[model samples]
Target chain A: MAGSGSDDDAFVFPVRTHFHAMARRPGGIPREQAIEAAESHLHELHHEFKEWLDQELAEIAKILPQSADEVTSDDPWVEAAHARCQAVRDTAATMGFYLVTFAANNLCEAFDTIRSGIEYPLDAIDRDFKTLLLARQEADSADRTRLQELIRRMENPSAALPPAARRTPSK
Target chain B: MTRENLNLHGINFLVADANAYFCMISQSILRSFGATKIYEARNAMDVRRALVEQRIDFLLCDSMLPPSGGLELTRTIRWSANSEYRTIPILILTSDTRLNTIAMARDSGANMVVAKPVSVSGLYNRIAWVAFHPRSFVDSPTYFGPDRRFKIEGFPTGVGRRKGDKEFSVGEEDGPALAQDDIDSLLNLARKA
Candidate 1:
């Protein structure tokens, strides 16, 4: 459990100022309870967002092509996939899942550019989705750091990956 | 006021969020802050029904409600002929912090926009700011909401009254009116969502 006094001050968040201010008000909520509640919400979001991501990825599998040249931006299935991708971005951002949020954002931006008649690598989106799922399972800082490095390597494939981190893209 | 001193005896709150966990957590935070009679709405229709059926004082809404979402709901509450809560304080809580999203929130008549995963103090301060020390409401041809200006005399260089352009204030009665196209551009951004 994250103690209110320790966890609140440890994180450098701008909103904590607001929380402290409200906590001082004559009839405001306590800082400890608020932190606890927020932590609980984050736990639930992790589970729920994981389920949502799986469903979205399943849907994307049915529509997305193995190559970039086969689809247009206006296709109904593509549009639907974009919507789900956006939902993932928004929800992950809300939960403070920074890696998933970052990957989803880039994927959306790539799609937007592709829709505007720009030719780009479609494999990047799949790689980003895979990275999002990998980041989801990372529960520690070292694991997260390694995953971040893998994302970087995936982006710049010229960079070599360690033997333990190398893998084939399943989709 | 301290935690024990905080007194929300008669204040009624409505929290509109599609996420059940978020709703529950927000309610818990409010209750800890001494608030009672907090209502939850999961969708836009439930929000409308809650407004019509209850005497709601403050509204905390998520930006991504189903159907049309919260920005459209803000427009409806602000401009609807049948709404009695046009002047009620609305605070948008969401994780979408795109520049266009913030602009739409301002243009749609929201009192404040707080990013999600907010701290208790952050939520409380915004609610207190809205409830007690609100900015003057503005009803322009293309916009209707609390004044977007947070600073009175802190415009960046060359932007406002620099080089002695003119000394003036943007009160409820006097300000530069936004063009229709500018407003349309923002609404268009919301549509892209």
Candidate 2:
């Protein structure tokens, strides 16, 4: 009886209360205990996380255009690469790969801008790919911060750069 | 907001994502919360099959699910005329938290949109929120889904946009401003549930 109503009027379906009954059952573990267990499970899978991340990165690399001429917003490969970047963004942080998450997020934003008809420079995308590779190799916080700044510049080209960065001549 | 334990033992969950590792991560979190019957699907076709085969109580779907996307799948489920699962709660998980994407998910009838790189606490809180705060499904000409309006503190500009909306006078501000903790507690009350 949920969707049976006149199109001109709004019909309200009554709330389903069964979930409350099911979730409030007896013998539930403490909230902290549940979180700890889940975290432990994730930690146990840390070994596999590296392999998974590598595979995802390889897939993204494989799908990326080899040249600016090969890049097309409408291409299925572009979308595929974007989705893989999203997957890395979504899972990396949970496994303690915050730098990887950061780089993937930057790549996803770049992809979003490109999909919206903006003409993002190919060098920016290539730099993001390199940043991802560097993030995988470097775990130091200082190094991560430096990489993040590099991505920030790539994402916002017109923004004022640091004195040291500005002093360096354009490639 | 005091944390309350969740018992998801009897609640069946279907997690649909193209990434196998992501699916495994979701399953691990759900299992830790006491869920026993968790199903996995990698595409829209698999999702439909799971919905038909399993008595799914909840769905955690990736926004970029392959073939037909998650939003499309959600709309299909919402508009399905003969399916009991049409009204099941859906929570879309995504890394893209853009306003447009969130609006699309809402318009597609999802109960909630959870941002990804999901922390255990965040995931638990969202699941609890969806379970405890059930919204009334709206069946209108243009939309067939949960009422998109999450709050009814009278529309801004003191006017309603819809034809049937009732006109109401705006009341004067009352009482002192709430502290940040109070606001957080109110927003995260489901964590206590």
Candidate 3:
């Protein structure tokens, strides 16, 4: 919803038709139909969330290089990066995508830790920045696995899947 | 109980919400206890990490924060040895009154939850009560309503009329319902109920 125009509009339409149509149907689309609808909407939401994550991570990766080298430029773009990262986090949480959420959350913490290390001492910020960059890289790598797991979750919300380390303690 | 021995030295507390108003409200609630040391984090991770690395006593955590919610932070603090920053009492401050949010907050390791439009007395009652009995819910012993702060703890709690200034009847425990003849008073209390 932050960016402009009709793309956001598309997220609402087809699912909405199914929603309204289901609402008016005889006795609300039977048990099987209800399950079908739930699965349908969840899949849509999952895909939508993944698309958003992919776009944001790509944008962040692009920004890292641009901002990393320019010493005079915002000397600290960490806060802004965090602000953008926070937006990604909130969306993941609201969507109940905890794996992605967990990674994003930890990544943000690392960014803050490095940013806070900015003191009169010269190399602290740079050292922190390097640590933060590693964290970002690790998160980018983890996103693929999380995205696949999330897609699987959409297919069967109740599936008792094998416990992956990434899923547990996703708090 | 009373604002007695709660003053600790000049501890600086920081709050870092992108929302200035929410941060201001949190600052005011923390300041009420005369605790000069308070800090705010823009989100959970920053605050949690700083709490471990610094010296902070009471933490007021927001349940719905960006990146990760406060629960994740609480877990990290409680479980990780590197973050054993004492069993610092944490009171989760949230505007969300939803059952799921409350459950989520507790899941995150909050000792208690405070609903928002945060009130000073509510904040005080919650903080003191939690600090007094950390990890256990304290049943509020007195009824808080419009006219007075009275009790139903035993021996005809309210006096025969308003016996001048006050009198203490220190026996038994009585329920909220008394004579309906005091229906106005009863209704007043009932309205709150």
User: For model 2, how does the per-residue alpha-carbon lDDT over A39-126 read when each residue is reduced to its tens digit?
Assistant: 9998888778878888888888888877874344776677778888988887988876777788888898888888887767778888
Q: Locate the minimum summed-lDDT window of 10 residues in model 2 chain A.
A: A1-10
TM-score of each: 0.62, 0.76, 0.36
Tens digit per residue, CA lDDT, model 2, B1-193: 3444577987889999988999998999899988999999999999999988888888999888988789999999989978887788899987778777877787788888888888987787777776655677777555677766565432223222366676655568686544334433553463345
Q: Comparing to the true complex, what docking class would candidate 3 get?
A: incorrect
Predictions in order: lDDT:
0.64, 0.77, 0.47
Q: Candidate 2 vs candidate 3: which has greater TM-score?
A: 2
Model 3 C-alpha lDDT per residue in residues A21-101, reported as the tens digit of each score: 222233312222333443344345565556556777666655554323323323465666665566555545444455555
lDDT of 1 by residue, A1-171 (tens): 121221211211112222223423565444445445555655565666566666765766676676665445655556566656666676665565666666777777777766776665667767766766565565224355676675676678755867668786799
In CAPRI terms, where does candidate 1 land?
incorrect
Give the per-prediction TM-score of chain B. 0.75, 0.76, 0.59
Give the runs in model 2 whose Cα sits over 4 Å from its true position. Answer: A1-8, A69-76, A139-171, B1-3, B151-193
The lDDT-based order of candidates, best leading, equals: 2, 1, 3
lDDT of 3 by residue, B1-193 (tens): 1222222234445454544335644554454444456676777667767666776655676655666766666555544544444244566766456676765565444556776435444454554444333232111112111112233221121212243634554567666433223534554465456
Residue B111, model 1: lDDT of 80
Worst 10 residues of 3 chain A by lDDT: A10-19
For candidate 2 chain B, which ten residues in a row score worst on lDDT? B152-161
Clashes per candidate, residues 3 or more apart or on different chains? 13, 0, 13
